[model samples]
Target chain A: MWLSRVDWEKIIKHLSILALVEADTARIESLARDLEKIVEMFNKIVELNIPEIVEPLYTTFFGEINLEEDVEWESMGIRELDPTGERLEDGYVKSPKTL
Target chain B: MLPPQCTQFSSISIKTLRERVREDSDFLFKYVEEVYRAIERYEQRLRAYITLRPISEVIDDIENLVKHGKLGPLGGALVAVKDNISTKGIRTTCGSKMLENYVPPYDATAVSRIKNSGGVVIGKTNMDEFAMGSTTENSAFYPTLNPWDYGRVPGGSSGGSAVAVAACEATVSLGSDTGGSIRLPAAYTGIVGLKPTYGLVSRYGLVAYGSSLDQIGPMGRCVEDVAIVLNVISGHDPRDSTSLRVNVENFEKYVVDYPLKRYRVVVLEEMVSEGIDEKVMKIFNSTLDVLAKRDVTVEFRKMPLLHYSLPTYYIIAMAEASSNLARFDGLRYGTRSEAEGKLWVDAYRKTRMTGFGEEVKRRILLGTYVLSEGLYEGYYLKAAKVRRLLHQEFTKLFREYDAALSPTSPTLPPRLGEAIVDPIKLYSLDINTVPINLAGLPAISVPGGFAEGLPVGIQIFGPPLSEGFLLNIAKLIESGRSG
Candidate 1:
């Protein structure tokens, strides 16, 4: 067996919600107040792990990619493959959602 | 004390029960009365049930089925459902006070499947608060008794479903296995149970335990009857996100072609060692002897990652369970007492304290601990890494062999009170079956033989979506008269 039975009652009582609120309410409230700060710190830790080179990589190759560079390619009259078979039809080209 | 043997009804199979109804129009009316009487007699002792509806309603459903000229494949079959599965009008308690009064407005995918196929839902079976514990003893209402011996556990959290099947209260029952909830109970009480592969069957309305590990399966006296029920219930349903988009086929068709003769099987020698009872090992070895005679090649293989499976599974499952079960506060649905004057923060605390069972609270607390600050990486994240390793090991092994076989549980069902003091011992009951859950593969527990006069089971595990092949191989072993 992986889990052993314990005196759960004893553990539950000390950690009971009533006791926590009554006794250490301020500390509990402060801990609750600091939750956002904790989340912010964790976010910072995640951001700190990002490689510096990735920022330039994201800006240069990704941002500067020109959609108009393929004007001649677009004019080749190569029809895109319609997966739903509607692009080949007369006047009614079916968007995925419409289907 | 244990309930007396069922009177007015005793030792009836699904076929015979259907035949009785067909031969005499009034037969099922009498059987319904007997079911009511039986409910009155033993419902208290077994606590195997949460509610028993009026027999008149059941008769109405049967009459409607007949009026429509619809003869169901499971005609007149009575089944006890594990409370986790939704039934439209019945209160689905999931063995916790959380949803004590929450009646589902619609049926679960499986429940609807059963009703359409001519099966009647007799009652909501007890489970481990939220299908968490190995012993049904953890149930909030009352623990289900083992029909073979009440003093012993029926094996849970599907204990009520297994006991209801074993005691002949119902012809068959459905159980969900997150970690051996189905197979372990089948082994504990002599019966056939299957945990079909992930997404093979819809999980649309099953109360979530561990989303990835949970699978709904059938329990019955023989493999064929289980297959019959599986054919009806196992299919695509758009309601569940994970439900497979595949054609449903009769599982019995797979057995007809004699596929067992050509397939290769591997038995994990290391897994069957140490923790296994001596008597169980004897029967398991004899079962292997039967297979050897049939020219079904059986060889012992070792998978080292299986050693770490238990810890990996518990960490991941509880972590998921804690998050899933958080929906059970008093406000949404279920038994909720007034924490009125207290703020909403304290209200969640008090409602959960009184409403949830000890085992439920334990898992929630443990889950909270595992996912808490500074420990999530060490516990939950590490377990996920180990689970990937376990899956990788099985994937590598499956490439070489069609399926792997092992003793479903290391020991036969322990007497009810023997291990309650030791939760770890009870949790370890899932040792063999957990690996299958962890790998997200398919497995079944067929009646292997007897260990110390109690039932033992042989578990057949295969690659994902191989329920057809797994059942065929299990049928071969189950029907082995040569042994």
Candidate 2:
């Protein structure tokens, strides 16, 4: 397996995605196995014989995005925004201390 | 006069329902009551809806429309919306505990349009969490059962919408197809599902799964109903930057006066290879025979790159998903963890850990891994290159063929637990449909035939913005079946 040589613990730490660490060992191990299988499947792309000159297709259709004129519009009311956050006090959302 | 009982609902089309409601005052209320009765009967076993609108609310909406005398094309038609699409003041759970109580302050552009066209929002249907899985089993709340057999899955992530239509819980429904979400479920439930050309429909309030790949479309029991819903939900919107500026055609007209002409259709040689269900193959072949008799010439063509679509789709879709899902941190919208003294990052982690399901975490991890340094070039970039190749191949093939036909799914509706055992197998089932999404082309899955008493769907693919052409072909096939 391609992932057999790689250290998953180190990779997880490098990414700083604490979600990976939060997963149980079995879940992480299963993820590794699944990733290896998926990567192996993706390795089949090498067999497609794509020429180096062909540019990658990032966007599906290449049409110029017609940006609307920058105009001010009525924003959502503060009361409307109140319900969508953790806590609403003095028209502000309460959050954990960053420091 | 009232239309009919809930048992006879599937036979009536949205076009007929609209006309009946307009001609008679009491027909609308009767129809709504019958639909609610059907929901009450089927919803317990089917589990199709995540949140059903009260019959009173629907009646109120209809009464207001009648009072104002402003009935649009979808007059008094009951529509089930997939929960992922935002509905103002309604809890739009994307089948995740994360958004369990999150009610949006605005309706999705499609939902707003449906209401404007005199369609009554009946309920929000169940889906795979954040539209991730093939079977509805990945939903955090509960897996929606296929209306055909309660033990089997109604293919997802739009399973509920598909079931709502199939089981006659709603007149029509809306579902978003990122990778065969709508079509797979529609196929499983014996309904018509269209994944419109990317940018054809506005994605303004759709919970972003794969932003570039996701397009919300219609699901119904027949071509006419799907086309009517499509007509109402389509057209460019300024809110969504990617919304196409092209003029929206009256898609329902194609269903009515469908031009009966010889259509050059190509069958993908790769799709019919080994591992396809024998019963599905029988239905697909017979459907081709029906098409041939209708002057739709069928020919087999080899597109070798078609085999790479699944891996390519997952790589791109997951990468986009990881980026899009970052907005669901605890401090923002959605459910927050009870973290008093924990670090902000820990709070985010705790919230996500408790909220997201296993399938969601797997995808997020895989997506993060692919986009990580060093591996990004090896996997993500190469996938993009392959995607371009697949797109080019499809583009070249369309030059000679009017449409490409294939089985919507490799197998029949799986037993509820069958797909959950193997995630990779679930991903592979999307092989036949994802290529169309990759190329941003329009495709529709029509009821091809029955297999072992279950419906099998034949998908028809057309070039970009050729929805009218695609629907006309589907309408012709549907007519050929009944005739």
Candidate 3:
């Protein structure tokens, strides 16, 4: 495996606390095993004898992105994401811990 | 009266349906009624929809639609949307527990185009949760059953959209293909699905899963129908920076019954070599045999990098998914379980932990791990570089041949609960389909034939902006199979 158990545990812990999602400790052992298998499958990709300097290609073509003038337009009109509008405070959608 | 083709077994062409509606206004109402009746008959068995519009609501909308004069090509067509594509005021759950109650305030660019072209959205179809798994069994609500065999799964994450069209639940449907999501389902259900060139359609409102690879495309009973819907949805949208600026139009005209005189195409040698199920290989070979009898020039060529595409696709997709799905932290939209703590950070952690499913979480964890500081260089970077080599390889191949051919899925639809248990098994099903997405090319999967009494799909992939060309290529296979 590319990652050792200690490495896996350390990464998962850091990720759950800092990154986009959190993991339930109960599911971690199984998820770690699943990740190991997936890594075993995908790790082969890094092994291809490609040139050391091949650039990472993103899109097929560089799309011509003409940024439209920064003009005022109608927004999504969402003041409170809560459908019933009950989560508002002081004319703003309140964060759970704020106020 | 509706066209004779508008019978129970087959659907009418978009153009024919439009003309019929023009001649007899009431014709559309009756046709739509029949569609609803068909849905009522089959939806219970198929579980194709996560949210079907009530018959009364659809009727009222159709009534208003009829009062307006000029109908676009898709006039009065009943459209089923895959749940991943946002429909205004419609719950876009992405077939996950996470956003089960989340309704979008706007329609995806493709959905809006369908409405503007006079297509009526009948419902949001079920899908794999956040388009992660191959079988809709990954869906939180229920696994969608194949109309061909109730014991088997319809291919996913666009499984329900494909079944909706196959079983006469909707006139046509829009499904987002990221890997084989659209095509595999279409193949399994014996329908037609196209994954347009990556940037041809806007992804403005599509819930992102592998943003680079995800494409919103059309699914139908025929190539021309899929092409017509493609016409409506394709073109530049300033909203998506990646949306191609090129003006490509009138895709339906390309799907013609013409001879493929001197038309050259190639089959991936690896496609038929290994990993393909024996029954599916037999069907694919026969499908190619029928083409061999034609004036077209076909050859078997090896594109070595294709074998690596499945892994490359999974790595890239999981990375993008982790980043895109991060927004679903339940603060602003989607599900919010009661906060277990006062800290916003804890609430955020709880929301994501509670919201995402096992498959979703697994991918997220893997994605996050690979994208982390040291690992990104080794795993993600290597995949991206390899992706470039794969892209260049296809570009070189396309220069020699007009298109490439492969079976849409390696195997026939597995029995329910069969593939869902094994993630590698599910991921392997996308081997033939993911390469096209990695290259940002167009592909159409047509109903090739039956294998083991189940449908097999043959995909024709082409160069970027070659959607029209690919559709015509698919037409050759489709007509040959049927006629």
RMSD of each: 13.0, 2.9, 2.9
What tens-digit string does per-residue lDDT give for candidate 2 at B1-483? 111223764446787887787688888888887788877776898899999988888899999998997668887788899999999999999999999988888999999999999888899999999999999999999999987778899999999999888888898999999999999998998999999999989999999998879999999888989999999999889888888888899998788534445789999889888578999999899888888777788999898878889888999998888888888876777877775555777778777878888788777777787888777876788889888888889889999988989999999999989978777788987889899888899999999878777888889988888898889889877877777
How far off is residue B417 in model 1, in Å?
Answer: 2.3
Model 3, residue B18: distance off in Å is 2.4
Q: Which candidate, 1 or 2, would have the higher lDDT against the true structure? A: 2
Residue-wise C-alpha lDDT for candidate 3, range A39-75, written one tens digit per residue: 8888888788888889997666467864777888765
Q: List runs of model 1 lying over 4 Å from the truth.
A: A1-99, B1-10, B15-42, B255-259, B481-483
Look at candidate 2 and tell me the lDDT of residue B78. Answer: 87
Error of 3 at B354 (Å): 0.9
lDDT of 3 by residue, B248-365 (tens): 7788788887743467889989877777888888888887777766677888898788778888999899988889888987777777767667777777778788888888988887
Over 4 Å off, model 2: A5-21, A82-99, B1-6
Return whichever of 1 and 2 wins on TM-score. 2
Encode model 2's per-residue lDDT on A9-92: one tens digit a residue.
455444436333256555666655666666677777745666777777876755557578999989877767665555777767
Q: What is candidate 1's lDDT per residue for B236-287, written digit by digit as tens?
A: 7767666776777778776542454477889877788868888888888888
DockQ each candidate and list the results.
0.02, 0.43, 0.52
Using alpha carbons, what is the TM-score of model 2?
A: 0.94
- Candidate 1 residue-wise lDDT at A82: 32
- Structural similarity to truth (TM-score) of each candidate: 0.81, 0.94, 0.94
- The lDDT, on a scale of 0 to 1, for candidate 2 is 0.84
